[model samples]
Target chain A: MNFLAIIGRVVLALLAEIGRLSLFIWQSVSHIFRPPFFWRLVAQQMMRIGYFSLPVVALTAFFTGGALALQIYYGGNEFNSESIVATIVALGITRELGPVLGGLMVAGRVSAAIAAELGTMRVTEQIDALTTLSTNPYKYLVVPRVVAAVLTLPLLVFVADIIGIMGGFVVGTTTLDFNAGVYIKNTVDFLKFDDVMSGLIKAGVFGFIIAIMGCFHGFHSKGGAQGVGRATTNAVVSASILILAANYVMTSLLFAN
Target chain B: MSDAKIELRNVHKRFGSKVVLDGINLTVPKGQSLVVIGGSGTGKSVMIKCVLGIIRPDRGEIFVDGKNVLKMDSGQREAVLRKFGMLFQGAALFDSLAVWENVAFGLIQGRRMKRKAAKDIAIEKLAKVGLGPEVGELYPAELSGGMQKRVGLARAIAADPEIIFFDEPTTGLDPITADVINELIVDRVKDLGATTLSITHDMSSVRKIADRVAMIYKGKIIWEGPRDRIDDSGNDYVDQFIHGRAEGPIGMDVLKP
Candidate 1:
């Protein structure tokens, strides 16, 4: 009976959390469509979320691409199909690694920052202060971040796709003894526009998830310094998990045909 | 009856099994400073948040200028909130913004005033709080605790709100700084002739700024009277709290044998 009661409590708590998150998403998205938009804030968030994140995202993609090319060359050599390395590297980077890796990296950097900042604001009563000042915090704080992330992630992923393929190309030509012209030809020939488009679409969704999770956890933080710290941790972990889960779902849907 | 600028009629709030505010009834008259005093976790902050629409009470009504604020829609609520301002316990200034921008946030963002015009008013308000124009350019992180409180006070009165709420305006300050803040509160309230509701456990602040004093115990306002009458209220809880005594009717829930 005690075990059953414990299970019941866990189930109920989980359901309540889901309900709260759904309501937060609804409120934030609805506020995004309302009037009195803060364009200046949105622009500022773009710089913070997108431009500042370029270095980390690029580095992650570049290294992943280089490693992927080497792995493909080694595996294909066993089948006497080592020429397939350039083709597979380009397709893999464009279709999956670019968006997924970029999302995960940004999830770590941007999500943690957003959560810590908003959590501090929540614990300190700045959010309540915004209310008394005739401003909706959703409009003033959450909307700019959500909008920036949704718009900026796809652009970041696009850059990552380019940088990732370049890294692969460099490894293939220099380390794998592949001719530069042939490697470029093989990559461009095998890669489809649909593959790139699908990844960009996934990037946009990943961006939305990252920002929503950060804002949700941060907005609900309680206690004080410890609570803010907990929120920051929760935001990054939840966003990274959601990004991976979302990437899988999107991949199956986009590629099932 | 019509003279009451703010009124809470039997407001009730609870978090899960714990009741934070239980049937709290209070009123603040026009052009007066009514301070609600209570120890930590007594729902003093919750009660003020309820009035500001930051927290929804489980039962009862809150009124500002005879309009039931709890029943107003989002647009109506925003319009109603335009008449009010607040100063939070830790000052709650937006760290992302400069000092002047924090003061002018409502003016520029909520009222849609141009930046140049709003900045002029922000500087004026900062001056009223004894901060120079140069201080306005610095961020909240750059200011001392006392200066942040003054900036918060300046922001509260920036829009010339008809009503103001101060949530523990002197919790972390030194005694001398606290007294300075109390003086500023008194001066600002006098200059604006605004009806003010402040929640604090600081007895000195009550003596310096409160026209009327209310004491909350166990989520209810147990005693209320003019400031001059607080010493002779004849309530045990009031006596214990005002005197900062650990013994008497208000017992600490620390360690039990």
Candidate 2:
């Protein structure tokens, strides 16, 4: 009975946490459509979340694409070498790796930053201060990050897709002794529009998850510096896990025939 | 009081099993300052937070300007919240924003005033708090604790709110600095003719700002009267707390150092 009670408590706590997160998401989303929108703040956050993160995402995509091309070339040497290498690289990057890897990178950088900023605000009573100042903290703080993330992630993923494809093209032509024109043609011919579209859709969802996790953790953080630190770590960890989980679920649904 | 600007009736709030506010009944008359004083963690901040809608009470009715805030919709609650301003303990200035932008946040965002006009008013309010116009260009991180507190005060009063809340306004400062802030608060509050609700353990601040005083112990208000009666409340907890004595009805279970 004692063991069951412990298990029951853990389950209940998990359920409670899910409920809290759902409530936070609902509140943040609802506030997004409300009037007196902060366009400038949204722009500022886009700069911070999407713009500043460009180089890291770009670098990651390039390296991953090149490595993927090399691996496919080595492993599938028995198959139609040139066609298979180019097609798989394009399909893989556009469909799965682009959004997933980009989301994880952003989830690491942006989620931790948002969580740390908001968590510090929370522990220091700044959130309460906003409420008393007649400003909705959701609109002023959460919405900008959420809106920017939702809008920018797709853009980031698109950029990643292009960069990743180029990385593969570069590696195949220079190292694998493939004709550059043929590689590009093969990539274009095999890759469907739906592949990229689905990834971009996933990017949007991943963005939502990242921002929500960070804001939720930050807003609810208690204690002081230690609590803010915990929030930052939780934001990154939860966002990364959620991004992967969400990517899997979205893939199954989006790709279902 | 018929003229009550803010009133709480039998407010109860708890975190898990720990009750932070237990049947708190309080009132602040229009244009008057009511200060709640207690030892640390005695629910003084929680009670005010409950009033501000930052923390909801488990079971209670909160009225602002005779309207039941607990039952109001978000739109309605926001309308009511416009009357309030708050100065938090740690200053809680937005480090991301310049000091001027921090002060102008409410005017530009909440009141929808033009930025140029708001900037002028922000500078004026900063001047009221003994901050120079040059100080407005610097960020919150550039300021000392006392200066940050002043900027927070400026932000709180920027919108000319009719009601104000000060959460530990005199905390984490030297005696002279705390006194300076307390005097500024009194001066600024008097200028606005705003109703004020403040929570602090600082006796000097309590004496300087409060028209009426209430003491909380173990989540309940144990004594309340005009400021003059605080030293002679006839309540043991109140007597012990105000005298800053360790030998008291409160903290009985904790061992003396």
Candidate 3:
């Protein structure tokens, strides 16, 4: 009975969290459609969330793609290994690894940053200051971040996909002793438009999850510096988990026959 | 009382089982400077927050200009909020924005004023707070604590709001700087003909800026009177607080070593 009570408590806490997150999402979305749209803030957030994240995402994609090509070459049958390496690398980077890995990387960098910034504002009473200044905190803070993340993540993933494919090409031709032309041709032949599109779509969802988790935790932060620190940790952990979980659901739905 | 610009009746707020505000009732008459005096954690800030709609009271009605603000819809609440400006305890300046942008945020975002025009007003407000136009270019982080508070004061009065709330406006400042802030508050409130609500433990601030004074103890207003009458209020809590006596009716919750 005691164990059942503990399980019940956990389930109730989970439900409460879900409800709170859903309400926060709804408020943020509704604020986006309302007037007093902060175009400048949104543009600024884009630079912060997307433009600044380029190098890290690009680097991660390049290394992942290179490592994946090597793995495929080493593990596959000797006869078809070269062609299989190119085709699988291309498909993997564009359809799964680019968006998922990029999302996770960004979830670490951007989510923690947004949470820290907003959480500091919360503890310092700046959010309430905004309210008294006749500005909606959701519109001023959350909407811009959410919109920026959703719009920029797909762009980041697109860049990541291109760079990742280039990484595989470099590895295939230089290290694997494959014909560059043949590797490029095999990659192009096997990759479909839907594969890239699905990845971008997943990137957009992952972006939403990341921003929402960061904003939600930050906005609810109490106490002071310690509370803001806790919020930052929670934001990164939650966003990474949600992005991975979302990637799985999206991939199955998008790829299932 | 009928001419009260802001009024709270039976306001109650609780965090779990601990009550922060318990049946708080207070009033600020039109164009009056009313300072609420209390020790830290006595809910003076929470009471003002309830009036500003930053925190919703568990049970009670809050009125602004004869309208029950607690009952207003979001749109109506925003309209009501336009009448308000707040200076937070920590100044709460947006660290990401330049000083001018922080001051002009409401005018540009809430009022949709042109950037160039808003910049001019921001500089003008900064000048009023004894800050130079060159100072406006710097971010909040680059400024000293005193300068940040001045910037906060500039921001509070930027929109020419009809009401102002100062949340421990002189907190964390040296004596001379705190006095300068109090003087600025008095001058600005007079210029705008604004009703003001300020929360502070500083007796010097109370003497300098308040037209009327209210004392809060254990989440309730125990005594209220004109500024000159504060010393002779006859209430034990008021006497103990004003005299800064540790061994009075108010007990500190600290564990004895």
Q: Per-prediction interface RMSD?
A: 0.8, 1.1, 0.8
Model 2: which residue pairs collide? Answer: none
Which stretches of candidate 2 lie above 4 Å from their native place?
A: none
Model 3, residue B167: distance off in Å is: 1.2
- Per-candidate TM-scores read 0.97, 0.97, 0.97
Q: Stretches of candidate 3 above 4 Å error?
A: A1-5
lDDT string, candidate 3, A1-257, tens digits: 99999999999999998999899999999989988788988999999999999999999999999999999988886768888999999899999999999999999999999999999999988898788777889999999999999999999999999999999999989998999989999988999999899999999999999899999999999899999999999999999988888888988899898
**In model 3, what is the error at residue A127, expressed in angstroms?**
1.5
* Of 1 and 3, the candidate ranking higher by DockQ: 1
User: What would the per-residue lDDT of candidate 3 be over residues B1-257, giving only the tens digit for each residue?
Assistant: 77899998999999879999999999999989999999998998888888888888899989898989888999898899899898998998988789999999999888889999999999999999999999999999999899999999999999999999998888899999999999999998899999999999999999999999999989999889999999888888889988999888899997888
Model 3: lDDT of residue B227: 99
Question: What is the Å distance of residue B195 in model 1 from its true position?
Answer: 0.5
Tens-digit lDDT track for model 1 on A16-74? 99999999999999999999899988999999999999999999999999999989877
Q: Between the candidate structures 2 and 3, which one is better when assessed by DockQ?
A: 3
Could you give the interface RMSD of candidate 2 in angstroms?
1.1
lDDT per residue for candidate 1 within B1-257, as digits (tens), equals 69999999999999999999999999999999999999999999899889988889999999989999999998898888999989988899999899999999999888989999999999999999999999999999999999999999999999999999999999999999999999999998899999999999999999999999999999999999999999999999999999999899887898977
Docking class of 1: high
